[model samples]
Target: MLTCAVPTTLGPVIGAEQGHVRAFKGVPFAMARRFAKATPPLAWTEPRRCTDYGPYAPQPGQLDQPEDSCLSLNIWTPVGADGPLPVLFFIHGGAFVTGGGADYDGTFLAAHGPAVIVTINYRLGPLGFLQLHRHGLSEADNLAISDALAALDWVHANIANFGGDPDQVTLSGQSAGASMVIALATLPQARGKFTRALALSAPGRNIMSADHADHIARRVLAELEIEQDPSAIASVPLPNLFAAVERVGRRIADETEAGTVFGPVLDGSVIPREPRDVFADGTLRDVELWLGSCRDEMVMFLKSTPPAAMIRTSERNLRVAFGDAGWERLLACYRGSVRPDENPYEALLSDAFWHRPMADLARSHAEAGGAVWLSRFDHRPALEPFLSQGPTHGADNACLWAHLPDFIDRPILKRKGGPMMPADIDVAARFQTSLLRFVTSGMPDVAEAWPRFEPHRESLAIFGQPFQVVPLNEGARSRLWAELSA
Candidate 1:
């Protein structure tokens, strides 16, 4: 095995979880909970162990409790900054509920062509979303967005020392993380933080609206038994404050909270307003964007929702979520074509929340005069149809970073008895090549002379059984989009 030498910046970071080495973890970039004026962290010294992954930021309750000083970053650099290298900044997805940088390893990303890969840890759920109210402690409702901005700022200043070019930064993420990247493009604080952004499986308003956002902060404050004032709420103890978040999670899905106990707050501080509106109005940074979604993006969520509840979900709600024109268009495309369903609420949720938002976010960025690159991860899975979901979440993991077995264990996935087939390994190489090309030259489809996306005219790189450049499926896209945005 190739042993990893310690870097000057990081003494050495090690993990024995099978073929894992030459990778570093848990380096603090910013002060813990620094975004909020209220919360603080446990202290640490230079060269913090970082051998093991850090604890995740707070969640509402049970299952587990992350340590207080969990705000940190993990990095993988293939080589030194001998020359200017492309940069990929990663954000994790959790619906503001679960997930952390610890869940992913950047070795694949670092080895994918030439670039520096960075994954960050941010506050989640109540620790991130609950607002500061009129009465008591641990206020500052807009913690999630604030945490993201601070992490990016840390990268912009420090990535160069690790062989990454601050100017050529590419923001990459999936699910809620993808939504956060799209949101970052529009925030004044994150302005110039990255030159390019890629979103996979984003749900719109993962960015959010002012009133709905404000309510989150107010609710957090109310939990502390304080109302009307945010300052006092900010003073509460961090542990006490996090406990309330756990309490809310028990009945979030059915409650007024919509099962989302924590997320970006439209508190007018970290995040100014709805990201869709900002992009639509051209207030965003005007950077290049690459966005796409899988065809069966929601099977994961569907399998998890109670089967009995399936009977109760209102398709009309789906229509309202998407809108009339969108519904008709979707009905035309989805109905006649594939995935015909007795009822498609689960599919609707996927498109309405994840797929359409990413597409529109790309188009809006493109409409603002910035370049755009789009795609449909139509690749079929060797696994069961439901598991892979064409371009499901983590679908791109192998593609963008191939040779999983090369530097670490489990990079090359295997079944109990079947040999690991490189079925999509070649596709992953193509994806890595295209992504490398995009990061290096800002064009994932340089060969297509792939045109930029416009509100009136859209183009996409379809990645599936037979990869090809085709006009985006507008008929299917628009209707699904309209329904969700409605």
Candidate 2:
């Protein structure tokens, strides 16, 4: 066991050692109440023990109770490593309503690579994302995003003491977290803070306008039977608030076909414009980007939901994402790629909601003369017998973190969670190397040395058995997807 006095702008913090990795868990990056901007934590003269995980933000289906003080982060660094190593600043995804930094373990990445990994917890659901603008609390709107910015600012100020090169920071996230990454990349306040970014399975279209946010907020208030009084809403119990948020979220999903209920809104102040608009305006040209989605991203989420609802959701997503004509064109492009007996809605929804947007983002980056790499995670886990979800949404996360768990029960599938095959282990190692290379340098160092994503080529590095690079829209029906997007 080792300890270090890691100096911060606020003061020095004491972190414990775990083998070759020095871990600092549940380090408060900022302090904030619900619906308020996060501020720097008070300076401490005494050493603060950062050994245990912090309280998670209030979220739906959270196993543990939630807390208001959720703006914390965890750090993992090579114990004896020298200073100025690259840093991976990760954000967890739960559709903007759940998850925290504690869900991920950064030990493998920190120990194996010349990098320090930092995972952060931002506020979620109503507290973090509910647009307070129309309620006369505009300053508190997008508090979750504000929390993220505070965390990044803390890292920029204090990471050097943890042997990290703040100058080489790589901001990364999956799903709603990925959406946050994209949002940060577009925000003027976040410019020049991070060198590069990686967005995995980001649904870039979920950002709402102030009007849309107001509509949703009013609906949430009505569903909870609360007056438009912000104070009254704030005083409601978290469980009650989460229930309303979930109900409102489902209603919105059914009504508008949006990906989430609450997310970063174009609040005119914090987030001025849609992320895609920012990309189009060449605002994100400065940040190198790597982004992609899984093959069956939407299927994992839809599996448990009623099949009829899933089908309706898919159809609604197509219409909302591309309009009637565009949706028809897109459906034609994806129809042939799906298997004969399989429901084509999954493929259609995946292409329209996930892959197509990713491809468009890549194209936008390339058009802006920015450096970009596109990839598709197609590695199927051995959990098929139990989970049966195919390379589903966020599956790449397990491989990236090397925390694939053993399914203890059921004799044959026991101990068959991660690296079940030789290829699984190889993919994980290569994926880690690619991430390390991107953070350290500007490019990913895959076995084949991945190429820049351009409109004409549309080359994508596929992470799976016999990992290789291929055209993103290579298959028969998918060939026309690029045309439809154009």
Per-model RMSD to reference: 5.3, 3.6
Ten-residue stretch with the least lDDT total in model 2: 406-415
- lDDT top scorer: 2
lDDT of 2 by residue, 1-486 (tens): 648677777777777887789999889889886666788878787778888888878666663544656778999999778778999999988778767787777887888786899999888778888886677664668888899999999999889889999888999999999999999888888877799999999974747777888888888888888755665776778788888877877667667645356778888888888888888777778788999788787787567645424356667765765689987776665565567544476777777678878988899888987889999888875655324777888767767876423211211112234334566667767777888888888789643567888767778899987778887765655656545556
Worst 10 residues of 1 by lDDT: 410-419
lDDT of 1 at 287: 69
lDDT of 1: 0.61
286-346 per-residue lDDT for model 1 (tens digits): 5677887776566555655452222123334455545667566665655554554323555
Whole-model lDDT, model 2: 0.78
- The Cα error of candidate 2 at residue 361, in Å, is 0.4
Model 2 TM-score is 0.91
